[model samples]
Target: DSQKEANGLRTDHWVMDKRHSTYLFFMGVGEYAIVKDKWKNIAVDYYIEKEYEPYAKQIYGNTPEMIEFFSKKLGYDYPWAKYAQISGRDYVSGAMENTTATLHGSDILQKPGQLIDENKWEDTIAHELFHHWFGDLVTAESWSNLTVNESFANYSEYLWNEYKYGKDQADYHQMEDVNHYIHNPSDFKKDLVRFDYASREDVFDLVTYQKGGGILHMLRNYLGDDAFFAGMNDYLKTYEYKNAEAHQLRLSFEKVSGKDLNWFFNQWYFGSGHPKLNYSYTFEPVKKQVTVIVNQSQELPFEFPLTIDVYDNGKPKRQQVWVNAAAKNTFSFDVSKNPDLVNINADGILVADITETKTPEQNLMQFTGSKEFKSRYSALTAIKDQVGKNPAATKLLSAALKDPYFRVRQKALELMDLSNADQLKALGADVEKLASNDPKTLVQGAAIAALAKTKDKKYLSVFEKGVNAVSNSVKANSVAAVLAVDPSKANTLADKIDLEGASDELLSQMLPIIVKNKVTSEMSNIAPLVAFYPFLKFQNPELGKSAEEGYNWIMTSDNLKATESVTKILGQAKGQMGENPQVKMMISQMLKDGLTKKMELLKQNPQKASSINPQIDAINKAIENFK
Candidate 1:
C-alpha cells in the first residue's frame, strides 16, 4: 500500500492499460459485488496484477452472456467487443451505464446486513447489464434523449427481472421508485438528466431511471407488448451503431405503433414536470349505489394505470381499470343495489395524490384486494402513510412486512414511520419475522434496522437474535438501524456483534451505523458503537478533518494513487515546507494518485476536464493550503 502511494499506480490504471483505448472505458473499484465471484467463469486473480483484477474479472464474467443476451433480445448481435463495470464506495446515485463500463455506488454491495435489502444490488447488476443493449449499444444522441438510454433499461430491467424472478419482484421495484417518480414527475430530486448538470455521479438521479422506466411502462401498456417490442427492435435496428435523438425515436415509434406518441412522450419525458390526475368517488344513496370519479390531477399528469376499487355496503367488489390521459373520465362497474363506498385509484395507478375518505374495514377490502402483490403493496403503503391516525394501517403494514419480494419488504421498511408504540412494535416484529423467513443479506439488514427502529426494550431479544451471527455489512446496517431506534440495546448488541477480519470499507460502513445513532445523542447513547468499531476513528479530529471533503486525492494524500500526503500539514513531514515531511507525503501521494486518476480521465478524454476537476481541485487545495 505504501509503495502504491509513491508509484502513481492504482487498480483503475492497470485496467486502462489493459483496455486498448479510452473511448469505451470507465472504471470503478469497490466491494459492492452483489454475489462476489458469482461470475467465476471469467474470474482472474485480482491479486496477480491486483489493481487490474476487478475490471478484468468483470469483463471476463459478463463477456459472453451479457453480449449474447442483448444480441438476440435486441434483434441484433453484440456491438461492442467488451464490457466492464464497478461500484464506488460512497456513490449515492443509482448506477451509471458508462459506454463499456457501468459504475454503481458502493452502498449497494453488502455482506448480508449493511444495506436495507439486496435485490436492488442484484437488480442493479441486471439493469446495467440490460443497458448493454439499450444505452450502450444504441447511444442517445443528446442529453435530452437520456430517456432513450434510461427508460429502455428501466423497463428492460423490469422485463428481465420478471423474466428471471416473476412479475412480483419487478413490480416491487418498478411500482415503488417509478410510481413515486411518476407521482412527483417534477420532483427534481430524481433528476432525469443526472448527466450534464450536478456532478458526474449525480447523473444517477431517480428521474431518468424511475420515471423514465414508468413512462416506458405506460408506453408499453399503451402500445401493447407486440407493438412495443417491434418499436424497440426497430429503434435499435435503425439507430444501431449510431446516435439517436429523442425526436428520432418518437418518429420511429410512431412508425412502429402506427399511433402518434407526441403527446405522451412530451408530457412525460421532454417536459420537466408531472401531471395531476384527480380521483373522486361518492355513494349515490338515491340511486341505491355508490359513484366514483377518477381524473388526472391538474398538476402531475403523466399517464399510467388507474385501478378503481368498488365496495357494496363497504364490502370490496372486484373492479379494475386502465385509465389513460383523460381530463374528466368516468367508468361505472357493477355495484350492489345499496353500495356504501367507492375508491378511485383503488389500484393506486395514474400519477396523482390520493385522499382517502373511507374506513380501514372499507379500505381493507382495497388493502387486501385480490391478494395481488402490487395492489397489496400499494394498500400497505397507503396504510403506512396514514399510520398516525389509522390504527388499522398496522395490520396492512404487517401484511406488507410479509411481502414475498425482498424489494417490497425493503420499501415497507423505508415507508413505515416508527413513531407510535404499537407501530414501532409492529415494525420490530416484522423485522424479526423476516430475519427468520428471509435469510438473505438485504432483507436481513432491513429487518435489523426495523427492529432497532422500534427502540422498544421488549424487542431487544429480537435485535439480539438478528444482530448476532451476521455479515459485516448486514450487522452494520442492522446495528445502525437498531442504534437509531434504541442506542442502549444497539450498544449491547454491537458489543456482541463481531468485527474480526472485516475490511476497511466494511468498517467505514459499519462504524457510522454504530456511532452518531439518531435514536440517541449522548456518548452513553453510542457507547457500544464508539467501543467495538475502529473505523469509528474516522470521526477522530485528525482523519475526520482530512477526509471531510471526500476527494480521493485529498483524503488519501494521493490524488487517485492512494498516497497519504495530507500527513505533511500536521507537521509529520520529514523535510522543509514543500520539501518537508507533509509536502513530501502530499507530493508523493498526489503524483501517484494524480497519475491514476488523471490517466484514467485522460483515457476517457482529456478534453473534458470536468470529469477530473472534482479530483484535481480537491488535491490542489489539500496541498495548496499546506504552503
Candidate 2:
C-alpha cells in the first residue's frame, strides 16, 4: 500500500507471509521497470532494467502457464498473494526462491533477436517457481535432507520440459543432468543424504541436485505415474507450511501406495556409490536361448529393476527382471533364433555406469529397432568413433542425422568427421539440408559448423544466409564460417555484431576467429570476450583456453586500441571482484605479467617501441589501479 506524506512524497508499506523462513526474505531497491501481468486474480510482475522492458514478457511470458501447470499437477493452489521476479546485476546465483518474489541474474534479459531463437532462462524460471511449493510451502528440515527442497526443484525442469515440449526434449535434458553427476568423479562416493558433511555448502553439489533428481525419476518409474503423483499430493498436503525430513517424505509415499519403501529409500538415499555393471551375453542356438550376464564391480550390490531388450532377426522382445543383492547375476531368455542384439538397461532408467559388449552390426540393429531415446543414443555413441573407418558405421551415422529427435540429430552432426573427404562428400547434401531446413536452431547451427569445416567456396551462400538467422548460435557459427571460407570479411563482421549477451558456445567459436584475423576494429564488442575469461576458466577448460588465447593476443598486440580496451575492462572488473579476492588477485597478477612482457618485447624491437609505448603505459596504469 502507498500513501502520500505531507511533504508530497509517497511511502509504501510491505507485508510478508507469517509462515516463511528467514532465508526467503528479500528486499530489492533499484530503478527498475515493472512489467505488470496477472494469473487468474493474483498479481504477477517482472522487475527489470528499462532497456529490457520491451523484452520482459518475451523472457517471462510463460510464467503464468507454468504456475497453473504446477498447481494442477501437485493438486495444490498457489499459496501466495502475488508472484514477482526481479533481475539483479551480477547476481550471486543463477536464481533464488524468495517466497513470492524470485531473484535472477541480469543475464535473463535478452534482446528481440536473441529471444527469436530461444529463451535460455526458461528452465531456471520454472525451477525457482517450483521452489515456491517444494522449498517455501514445505521446507526441508535440515541441510542434510536438502533433496526434499532442491531435488524436487531440479526435477521441475524436466517436468516443465516434458509438458511444454515432448518426451524427447525432456529425456535429452535428463540425460544432460545425469551426465553432470556422472562426469564428476570426485562426488561419486558421497551419499545423497549424509550427516558427516564438513560444511553446509558441501551438500549442495551435483549429487544433491542432479543425482537426487535422477533418483526421484527412478522412484516415479517404480511406483507408476498415478501412485507417484498421488503420493506427492499427500506429502505436500500433510506438510504444508512446515519443515520435514527425507524419511517423512518416504513415509508419505508409503501411506499413499501401501508398500514398504525402506529398500528404495535406504539403498538410494543412504548408499554411497552407483552400480557399475559389466554386461556380456552368450547364445545357445541348440536350445534357442540367450544367457545374459551382469557383473557389479562396485563394493556393494544394489537391488533394482533392470530392463533387457533381446533382438532376434531384427525384432525386439523386452523382459523386466529384478537384480538381487549379489555381485553377479545371470538370466536366460528363450528366443526364436540366434540373438542379434542383447541390450541391458534398455529404457535407461537407472543412474549407473554400464559397459556392454556388442558388435557394430548389433549396435546398428539396436539403433534401428529400439524405441527408447537412450537406447538409440547409446548405440550412436558406441559407433561414433568408427564413422570413417567402417562403412556400416558411416551409414548408421548418416541415417542418424535425420533422427526424429533434435538432440539425436545434433549429436550425429557433432560426431561427424568433417576432415574426412570421403565421409563429407558422401553426406554433404544431407548436412547442408539440415543446416538450411532443420527446425531446431541448435541443430541448424551444428550443421552450419560441419559444412564450414570443408572450406568449400560454394557453401558461402549458406553461411551468408545463416548470418541473418535469428539464433545467436547460428549467427556466431556463420561469422566463424565466413572467416574460415574467406578471411577478408573478418573486420566488417566483427564491427557489425554485438557480443555482449552472446552464449558461451558463441564466444568460444568467435574468440579464436578474432585472434587469428587480428580484428581489433571493434574493441568494445570484444571486451566481453576478455572479461568472461575469469568465470569461464573454471566452468569450461577448453573454452577457457580459447578465451585465454584471445586475452593474450590483446595484451601483446601492437594495436593501441586493443590495449586500451583490455585495460579499461580490467580496471572496471576490479570493483566488481570485491567479494571474490582470489579472482581479483588473479586479474591483478595477469595485468602485471602482461605489462612486464610487453616492456621486454618493446626493448628488443626498438624501431617499433615508440608506437607501442602508449600501450605499455596504459597497462601499467591499469595494474596500479587494479591493486
Candidate 3:
C-alpha cells in the first residue's frame, strides 16, 4: 500500500504488473464506503459514496459474479492482484477501466426504486470488466488499432447479457447497436482498422465501438458459438500481456476455426463502408420456390451473408444466401410449401441497410407472428411509415400496445397517430389507458404526448399529475403535453418548476415554449435557463443549438425590454464563461451574430434605432472584449 497520509484521507493504492501498460495504474482518494466480496481466490471491492452504501448491492454487488463468469467464459484467470470500482461525480465519460480499479460516474449510484425497470449498469459495468482481459492484459499495439481494445470490450456487453439476462435482452441490445450503426453510416466512412486519424480521440467513435461489435456478432453467428469462443480463448492466450494488432487477432480466429478469414476481414475490418441494400422477392406457388434479388447502393459494395426465412402458414423454413460482392445479387430457394410471408435478415446477424418489399398484409403478419423482437419492431416501424390506414395494420397496432417489451409499446404509441380521425376513434380509449398505467415511463410519456393531440380535456389531469412526477423524464415530457394542449399556460408553469433539478429534457422542451410565448418579461426567470448556457452548448449540443435559435428569436421579438434583458444576460456570461476556449468561442459567435441581426433590424426601422444604440454599442464592446 502507498503511505497513509497524516490526515487520514482513506487513500486506496493498487499496483499493476510491469507487463501491463503505464496507463493501467490506478489510485483514488475520497470519502467512500468499501464493500468487499470474493470470487474463488480473487478479491473484489466496490467503493461508493457513503450515502449510496445501502444500495451498493443493487448497484455493483454483481462484480464477483461477473468476474467468475468472464474468467470461465474466456478460459482466462483473473490477471490483476484484485479488482476495485468507485463512483465519482461529474465524470467526463461513463466509466474508465484502470488495471485493477475502475472509476464510474455518479449515475451508477441509483436507488432501489430505479431498479424496477432494468439494471442501468448492466451493459457499462460488464463492458469495463471485460477490458481487464482484452485491453489491460493484452493491450492494443497502437492507437491506430484501438478497435483491438474497444471492439472486444463492446462485444463483451453482448456476452454478459447473454450469459446473465437471456438471449432476448442480449439480442435487443445488439439490435440497438445495429440500428445505431446502420442508421448512422456517415460516421463510419473510414476503415475500421485505419491508421490516419488526426487524434486518438477520433478513433473512439461509433464505428470502433458499435460497428466493430456488430461485426464480431456477425462473426460469432458465422462460426457457431463454440468455434467463436474457442477462437476467442486462443486469441487471448496467444496475446496475453503483450500488445497485438488486427492481423494477429484474425490469425488466431483463423487458426482455431481452421478457415481463411481474409475475405471477412478485408470486406469488414479493413474495408471502408457497409452494404446499403434493398431487396424484392417473387414466389412461384406452382413450383413452391422463391426468388429474391438484392441490390447494393453503396459506393463500395460488401458481400454480406444472410438467412432468409420463408414462413409457410406460420412455419418457418430458412435458407442461407449471400448478397455477393457486386452491384446486384440474386438467389432462389426451393421451399417445402407455398410461402405466406418472407422475413429478411431473419437472424439479424449483419449490420446493413436492408429494405424488403412486402404488402400491408405481409407486414401485418410479420408484426403479429415474428418470434424475434427486431423483426416485430421492424415490421411495426415500417407500418408506421405507410400512408393509408389499413384496418389490419390498425388492429396489429392495437394489439401491440400491450407488448411485454416497453420499446414495442412505445412504437405502438408512435404508430397510433391520433391526427387520423379514423385512428383517433379506434384507439383513443387505449391510448388514455396507456398514458395513465403503462409500467415504463418512456411509454407512458409517449402515450401522454400523443394523447394531447386528441384535444381530450379529460386527459388533462394525467398531464397535470405527470408534470410534477418524481421522474424527470416523465415531468419533462408531460410539460410538452401540457403546452401542446394550451400554449397559454407555459409562462405560469415555467415559473413553478424548480429549474435547478430540471434535466436537459425539460430545458430543451421548455426553452422553446417559454421563448415562443415571450415568457421572460422579468428576466429573473431567464437566468436559470441561462445557467444552462456555455455548459449545455457542449454537453447537449442540439439543445444548445435550440437555445441559440430561441435566444435569437427573443432578441428579434420586437420587445425592446426582452431584447435588452437578453443582451444583459450575454454580457454577464462573457466574463464567467471565458475559461473554456470552446465556450468562449461560442459566446463570442452568439454575440457577434446577435449584434449583426440587431443592426439589420435597426436598418429596417430607423425610428427605434436611437433607443437601442446604447445596447448595440454595449454588445459591440462585449465583442471587443472577447477579442
Q: Give the local distance difference test score of model 1.
A: 0.55
lDDT of 3 by residue, 551-591 (tens): 67655544555555555556655655647777667767877
Better of 1 and 3 by TM-score: 3
TM-score of 3: 0.76
By lDDT, the better pick of 1 and 2 is: 2
Off by over 4 Å in 2: 4-9, 501-505, 516-549, 552-589, 595-627
Kindly indicate the candidate among 1 and 2 with the higher TM-score. Answer: 2
Where is model 1 poorest over a 10-residue stretch in terms of lDDT?
A: 519-528
Candidates arranged by TM-score, highest first: 2, 3, 1
The all-Cα superposition gives candidate 3 an RMSD in Å to the true structure of: 7.8
Candidate 3: segments with Cα more than 4 A from true spot: 2-13, 30-43, 49-61, 87-94, 105-122, 164-166, 183-189, 299-301, 311-316, 335-340, 419-421, 460-469, 475-507, 510-627
Clashes of each: 42, 0, 0
Q: Each prediction's Cα lDDT score?
A: 0.55, 0.85, 0.76
* Model with the higher lDDT, candidate 2 or 3: 2
